[model samples]
Target chain A: MDYKTVLTTCTYCGCGCNMYLEVMDGRITGTIPCKTSPINEGKLCIKGWNVHEFVQSPKRLTRPMLRKNGDLTEVTWDEALDFTASRIKSIKEKHGNDSIAFLTSAKVTNEENFLLQKFARAAVGTNNIDHCARL
Target chain B: MIEEIKKQVRELLTSGTIKGFLGLREIDGHIAPYLFCDAEDMDSMNLGDYKKPGDARYPLNRILIHLLSHYPDEILGVLVRGCDQRGLNGLYSLNQLDPEKVIPVGIPCPPELAEACECSRPYPENRAVDGQAEGYSNQTLARIAGLDIGKRFEYWMNEFARCIKCYGCRDICPMCICRECSLECGDLVGKGDIPPENPIFHLIRAVHMADRCVDCGLCAEACPADIPLRTLYKKVADIVKKEFDFQAGYQPDAKSPLNVLDQ
Candidate 1:
């Protein structure tokens, strides 16, 4: 019975279109293009209309997992981070630092992406950084 | 003209054959679709100006369908032009409507309104009451057919880019009956972008409209962007007819290309 529309910016791209996420009973139901948005001018592309579907999708990944006996098993964040660090360390030792590469996603926040690239260049010592949108 | 239709409605109401009628009523200079249950309220009906021309066939069709469904075995009369009559016929063929309990009072569009709609015909194939108007000239379709494919594509793309995805087209369409639309399908239409997966939404809708569109201009009128969506569907319908020799709403026996197996 808790129906409300939360005003937010579209996170799909850099355009930063304003929209309203219609929440029905605490569940994200749909998106409404903000009529007051200066950039979009009350129009939404097909994507903007369906922007709220993925947030409540059952298929979304929610936990860290490690491959165990050819199958992914749920693991603690500490274990996942330690495993990632050890693997990267081993890979750097085996191959040159320049061999490793990093890829960023547009879905993540700008601050998080900047930190990821910073870690990749400073810690992993590789400049081979790219993004999904590059392709 | 709406005044002429209202005059006819008064006759039908006085005949005691119909309990109510549906038509458009003028509201503060803008026209909205309305149902006229009383014969005394015919003064408010109007056929709008060219500057504010609108096709209320979709909403009127829905209102009629809803009324018939709610009150089965009741006789009701409605105002229909050629496009609205075709839409009603399409609905009847799909079994979405039962035409036996309804009386369609056909009101032929004047040359001016027909020209505005780019209409080829002004009278219904099946009319309960006769109307006074000649068939219209066909120029827009001919002009559209003269355009090159590349030019047509660009014209449609520009129009579609202005789409707000209001579902107004589907909402207004008499044939779009699916409770869940494919445009909301996860993989096909992406999420969180101002412009939907470029041209995919329009293309998908066109594909769906191939056998469904009855040349009603409701989609164009419902479109806030003023996209010529009905023209695209009209072209697609022509292609379907040329290839399959199947015309929608022509007859109840005629089968749609999408549903029937190719013989």
Candidate 2:
């Protein structure tokens, strides 16, 4: 009875396909392409169509995990960040910075993607920066 | 055209002939599917013309299916284009929808919309709007058919390669009401691969659509890859017509040609 559609743009690609997230009983249930948008014109790719699936998925990573004895164990923010920084530093020192790489996602904002590339080029001294959207 | 339809609906609602009328409504300049009840606002009622004619076509038949399940005993009024009427007939033949439970208020598509869709039947049998629009011949299917076997394979492969495997085509299809889909079967489709192993993934769906495609073209419209799905589905429909002499959803009382699995 409480079904409604919330209009929004797709976060998976630069195409900016507009879509409606169908909310039923306060839970995100499905995705319907926005018909009026000139960009997509009532069409959606696979990623745009299934954008709601991962929102409340049980497999989603809520806490940071660190590889301990070949097992990913959940850890606090400070501990995980410290571990990551130390690992990156050691890897940079052991091998050239080019050996390491940074991969960003389309899910994040433009500023966050900019920060990631900045971290790779200026902070980490590596130009090995890439994006999940294949940009 | 919309006023006459609205007037009829208002009369039906006031008389308690139907529990609700399912149609598109323009809300804050955006159009979406809405169910109108007794004494509701008729000004917002639309014939799915947001930017242009036939632009905001939702699967009303599909939505009606869901609505009927929630309110099993009540009769609901639905707006139907020629394509939608066919879908209703197909659903009826398959026993997915009880013919007695819903009332379809039909409308003919505008000539521009009908031509854009290349729909052979642009007017429903029972119509609220009075108009005649010519149904275009199946040119896309004929164009594809003109190609030789090798060129046909190359043409289809190039089109299929653009597929992101988004399943939007299936999701948007009104005929695709099956709870269990074969495309999701890992053993058959092979998981986590883009383009979904080419023609097989598409062919699997095409085979299923043979007996039930109402020629709505929503799947092709929903496909982000622009995969010419309408052409493919139309070809399947043509094959079914040729081989079995059956046109789905076209006949009033005829049952499905393939009744292999009953609902």
TM-score of 2: 0.81
Error of 2 at B55 (Å): 2.6
- Top candidate when judged by TM-score against the true structure: 2
Q: Candidate 2, A30: how far from true, in Å?
A: 1.8
Candidate 1: what is its chain A TM-score?
0.89
TM-score of chain B of each: 0.85, 0.96
The digit string of per-residue lDDT tens for model 2 on B1-263 reads 88889999998889998888888888766677777885466778988887779888887788788778767788989999999999999999888889998899999999999988889999888898799798899877788889999999999999999998889889988888999999999877988888689889999999889988998888988887889998888888889999778888899677767765655
List, residue by residue over B14-104, the lDDT tens digit for candidate 1.
Answer: 8878877766665444344455667887888755332434432325676677667656777788777777787778888777788787788
Shift of residue B26 alpha carbon in model 1, Å: 2.6
| CAPRI grade of model 2 | acceptable
